[model samples]
Target: MQDTYLHHNHQEKHLKSSELLTDIVIGMSDGLTVPFALAAGLSGAVSNTSLIVVAGIAEIAAGSIAMGLGGYLAGKTEQDHYNSELKIEYDEIETKTEVEKEEVRIFFREWGFSKELQDKAVEEICKDKDRWVEFMMKHELGLDKPDPKRASKSAFNIGLSYVMGGLIPLSPYFFVANSEDALKVSVGVTLICLFVFGYFKSKMTGVNPVIGGLKVMMIGAAAAAAAFAIAKVIDGK
Candidate 1:
């Protein structure tokens, strides 16, 4: 039992780490891409690095807030959906006790429990209303209780990640006086980061890291190139 508990705990911790990594990937991918594209577009049209820097910063701020809010909403939605299902489970257990009991027995039966053991397990489990409903929720409905702080935590993680990723391409503008020069440096830096970020993200999610990295780099490069080309065309007019 002690070893089982330890193993479960380890699994839970691993799941949380995976969730955090997913959030980072969500924020960082957009952060690096959007600002890099914006700077590239502006660099083609404008001569002043300061303007690009200001625009990039503004974009980062807005993107972070937007992404954070999106994460928060998604977390809240998960919590709300779980709570609603939990209430339904409780109601079913209360108003339809016999049916609920049979369902529990059926679940155990499917799990390879013998007839006598299923009866004994259902009786013991049904003795506690809370435990019974929780079991049903897990087994029948297949929903887990969402962490109460999931929303706030997701918001913070995504927002912070967006800021960090957005800064990479923008940093060059702050150092260089010319937009074109800053863009050249930004392209190199952001491309490298996109590749590295994608490699690790893929590895974490059990994908081909090298292929993932190259794909991400190509996508970012393509986006920036297209944005720059369009901006140059517009500026030429």
Candidate 2:
């Protein structure tokens, strides 16, 4: 119990920053993809500057609100799911102590403990309710406490990023009053942003930043390109 408490305290102090970065990448990627594609497609189809501006603005507003609400709801749902899982977890630990202890023994064995040591480790871990639940939550069920505020903020960031991403590609057309040039500018902006986002994501996930950025750029460019091409075909028909 004392050793486990010390380990937990140390782990808490060394809480990895990797999780936060991963969340940011997820938010950024989500923000960069859809709206840009949609805007590009619409711009190509309607070429009327006024219509493009109107549609683009509407998409940004709707997407932002939807994203924020969805984020809030999802965070709440996660908390609910964890609460439900905790009950099951408690029941399992309470009713099946010996079985759970052996289960944990096998788990520790896999992590490079000798058979005797693993049994001892499992005994130590399962002796306490908190340790037992923590182990099960981490290894067996893969659950964690949900932070509602963080989730909501993450969602808002995603939505804001998406709106910004969407507007980048469309703003040029409206201000420049030339659909083709605007498309070019919008696409250019989007690709750059995607590349930057990719690099950051890669860094967070421990991947190559350059490759990540390139991947993001390619996807954004491809989606926008495909949309424009599709719109062109539709208009021709």
Candidate 3:
């Protein structure tokens, strides 16, 4: 029993860590791509590194806030949906006990429980209303109770990740005097970062890391290239 409890706790912790990783990926991917493309575009149209730096900084600030708020809202929505389903589950168990019990029996039946075992299991589980409600919430609704602080944590994590990623492409502009030079360095740095980020992300999610890395690097490269081309054409006109 103690071993089982410890294993369950480990699984729960892993799930939470996975959620955090997902938020970082969402923020960082956009942070790297958008700023890199913006810098590349401006480099094609302008000669001043200072202008690109200022615009990049402003974009990073705005992007972080927007992404953070999106994470917060998504977390809140998940929590709200879980709570609403939980309430309904409790109500059903209270007002429709027999139906609820039958549902539990069906689950046991699906698990290949004997009729005698199903009866015993249902009785044991339903003895505690809270436990019964929790079981139903997990099996019937497939929702684990979300952490109360998930929204704020997600916001902080995503926002911080965004800032960190956005700075990578923008950092060259701080030291390079010319926008074109800055853009060249920025492209190299950002593409490498994107490949490395994608490699680890894919490994964590059980994918082919090399292919994933190349895919991510190509996406950032393509975005920057498109922006640069468009800016060049527009500036030439």
Candidate 4:
């Protein structure tokens, strides 16, 4: 029994990792695509090295804050929903203890429990309020309590990943920012990064990474083209 319990807990640790991995892919993908788009657009508009540097800096700062806030809000919203559901469950158990007991018995019945055994299980589990609530949440609502700290950490991870991803496209511009040469380099780097990022996400999600990557690459290219076209028209005046 000790070995089984230990193994179960050990397995749970691995499951928790899935959440962070998902956050990483999402964060890094944002970091790469967005800044790349911004850099490409600005690079087209002006060939000034100082201007590019300023734009890159601005994007890094603004984008990080924006991504972080978005992630934080999303996590908080999910947490709030879970808390509300939990409250409702608690209230149900509080006001209708007998009804809750019957529900638990029925649930275990489906698991092939005899009425005698089910009764004992229900009685023992309901003895603790915390344990009872947690059990109901898992069995009935299929949810868990949201940890504010975990959510906040996930948000931070996402933002940090975006910054890391965004750096890929921005790096080349500084090294070759003197002439229009840098813009092309940035575009080249951005497309490659987009494909790699897409592949990683696809692998995780079981999607076609090649197609996903190409689609992402096309989006970047289109954004850059539109920006360049606009700049050309503006310059014509």
Give the candidate number with the greatest lDDT.
3
Ranking by TM-score: 3, 1, 4, 2
Those runs of model 2 whose alpha carbons end farther than 4 Å from true positions after fitting are: 1-20, 112-120, 148-150
Write down the TM-score of every candidate: 0.90, 0.77, 0.92, 0.81
lDDT of 1 by residue, 74-107 (tens): 9999999999998888888879999999999999
For TM-score, candidate 2 versus 4, the one ahead is: 4
lDDT, candidates in the order shown:
0.92, 0.75, 0.93, 0.79
Candidate 2 C-alpha lDDT tens digits along 126-214 = 78898788788879888876665766776776666656656666667668676766777878787888888788767755689999899
Per-residue lDDT of model 4, residues 154-177, tens digit only: 778888888888788788877874
Comparing 1 and 2 on TM-score, the stronger one: 1
The stretch of ten residues in a row with the least summed lDDT in candidate 1 is: 10-19
The lowest-lDDT stretch of 10 consecutive residues in candidate 4 is 11-20
Q: Judged by TM-score relative to the true structure, which candidate is superior, 1 or 4?
A: 1
Candidate 3 per-residue lDDT, tens place, 119-220, comes to: 999999999999999999999888899998999999989998999999999999999999898888998999999999989887777679999999999999
Clash pairs (backbone) in predicted model 1? none
Q: How many residue pairs collide in each prediction?
A: 0, 1, 0, 4
Query: What value of lDDT does candidate 4 attain over all alpha carbons?
Result: 0.79
TM-score of 4: 0.81
**Model 3 alpha-carbon miss at residue 197, Å:** 0.6
**Candidates sorted by lDDT, descending order?**
3, 1, 4, 2
